[model samples]
Target: MHVEPVRSGAQKKEFIYLPRQLYRNSPWVPPLWMEEQNGYGRGKNAVLSDNEYELFIARRAGKAVGRILVYIDRAWNDHFQSSDGLFGALDAEDSEDTFNALIQAARLWLEKRGMNRIVGRFTRWRSSGGF
Candidate 1:
């Protein structure tokens, strides 16, 4: 699958819909957590603003498969005094190619914004993984 910026209103909806395909068979996960995924997928989080954050969705043959977000919170930078470009909201089927494309997209976005560093996992601390 390839990753690209979410293109239209319908595509945005498709971005919000990707988790359904990924998590439909998942068990032992609570309903509210699922709701948070839907909410953030649509960029409804309070910290989101048009000038700072943008989201992208991944698709294959016109079907949604994965997603990543590109964000630079002014307040976050102001407080931390850092130039790190934060990216998260990554969810996929554990495919290396799919994950790489998503990472490349976010990297390009951050590079365009003049950010050399990346901090993620959507938490106060970074998570260690293949990324």
Candidate 2:
């Protein structure tokens, strides 16, 4: 499997919707659809718009199997004087390889941005408790 940054509109949709497929027949409580869309919109979410962030999708055999969002909250870091990075909205298939690939991608991105510590599951909005 390979991980790619979510770039195109279709990939964004897939990133947002992959959890539905992954959690089908389970007790997952999905976030409101419009809220999810707005959260990812370029200027809709203050948290996302004011931070440095990227969304990624993992694909295997041309099918999406996992997704993640990595971000650096510069304002938070500046306030706390921390070199930390955060990741959230994690959804993945039950495959170790897929999980590793997705996490490594996030790690590398954060490292490139000078983050020394990694904090996670910083989910902003969701109907379910958390990731």
Candidate 3:
């Protein structure tokens, strides 16, 4: 397994595609918003428009198997009085290799930002907020 953080606009789009590719058969998974991604990747997302974020792609045996987005939302921090970092858009194969890659990328992103606490679909608004 290998992890490569995507740093360019074009490469970020590639990272976005990884999830759609993995879950094409999941009917419950709604279609992704490409426009949103373009905006977020290009730093146009209003909420975190000024914050720094990264998209990561994980590969196993030279094949893309997972993806994750790690973001540092400055506004969230200022508003909450905490380092409320976010991990989102996580998708992966069932295998441990795929799971580890996504998490490793997310961990690095948070660790670099001095974020002692983090949130994700596993324990945050990103996955269970919708009603």
Candidate 4:
């Protein structure tokens, strides 16, 4: 298994759509495709403009199997006076190894940015509370 930062257009698309594949048989209702795409677009998302973020994709046997988005919300840190990092948009296969690899990747990225704590699943609306 390999965990890598999403750096290509193809990887970005995989990151955005992984959930649909992960939850296909479940009761989950996937978000609109355009909405998902727009959320990652710098021009369409105010959060992207204000915060630092990275998207990652996990692959096994050369197949994408998981994804995560790690971010540092400046507003959240300022509002709470904390040096914390956040992660969300996590979609992974039902494998512990895959989940751990994704989380470790996010953690390392956050630590490198000087974050002292890690909080999670800070989805779009939840992250706005800091603002």
Candidate 5:
């Protein structure tokens, strides 16, 4: 498995679409396509409009299988007096290896930023909160 930053339109599309494929047969209700795209678009996500964040795509056998967004909310940190990194928009295949790889990537990304703790499992979309 490989984890890479979302750096291109194609990768971004994959990041947005992976969950749909993963949850298609479940009770999940996907958000509108455009809404998902805009949440990651510059100037589209209100809460994260001025926040620090990064999106990552995970692949296995050359196919996208998971996605994650790691972010730091300064206000939350200030209020809680902790530098905790948070992740959202996380989705993955039913493989433990894939899930571990995605989480390890997010942890490394956050650790580099000086965050000592991590909390997450939120969705990037306004409505859906889990995956």
Candidate 6:
């Protein structure tokens, strides 16, 4: 599996649809498609407009299999005096390799930003629930 940063609408769409596809027959109920799309948009996601963040999609054989979102909240860091990165909205196939690739991609991005610690759920979630 290989990981790539989500840089376009197409990538965002793929990232948004991953969980729905992966959990089609499971009990997970995904948030509305538009809501998922808006959550990734700078115009709609105000937190993103003010924070440093990136979304990564993991793929195997050219198909999206996982995704992870990593962000550094400068305001939160300044208030706490902590060099930490927050990762969330994680979703992946059952494969260990897919999970590893998603995590490594997030780690590399955080490391590049000088983050010393990562804190938060790496589970799949739109709000407080997970897949």
Predicted candidate 3 versus true structure: per-residue lDDT over 7-108, tens digit per residue: 776677777677677878877565547664664454565644677777788888887888877888887789889877787777788788777778877877
- Give the higher-TM-score candidate: 1 or 2: 2
Candidate scoring better on lDDT of 2 and 4: 2
Give one digit per residue, the lDDT tens place, for model 4 in 56-84. Answer: 89999999899988899999999999999
**TM-score winner, 3 or 5:** 5
Q: Give candidate 5 misplaced runs (Cα > 4 Å).
A: 123-131
Lowest-lDDT window of 10 residues in candidate 3?
A: 122-131
Per-model TM against the reference: 0.77, 0.89, 0.78, 0.90, 0.88, 0.88
Stretches of candidate 2 exceeding 4 Å from the true structure: 123-131
Question: Which candidate has the top score in TM-score?
Answer: 4
Badly placed stretches (over 4 Å) of model 1 are: 28-44, 123-131
Highest-lDDT candidate: 2
lDDT of each: 0.74, 0.90, 0.74, 0.89, 0.88, 0.87
Error of 5 at 27 (Å): 3.9
Q: Count the backbone clashes (under 3 Å) in each candidate.
A: 0, 0, 0, 0, 0, 0
Query: By lDDT, is 2 or 5 better?
Result: 2
Tens digit of per-residue lDDT, candidate 2, span 6-124: 98999999999999999997999998988888887559988788889999999999999999998999988999999989888889999999999999999999999999887888534
TM-score for candidate 4, residues paired by index: 0.90
Query: Would you list the rank order by lDDT, best first?
Result: 2, 4, 5, 6, 3, 1
lDDT (Cα) of model 4: 0.89
**Model 5: ten consecutive residues of lowest lDDT:** 122-131
Please, what are the lDDT tens digits per residue for candidate 1 over residues 1-131? 76778767777766666676788888725335555555553366666643376778877787677888778877878799988888877877668888888888888898899888878866543465533
RMSD of each: 5.4, 3.4, 3.6, 3.0, 3.5, 3.7
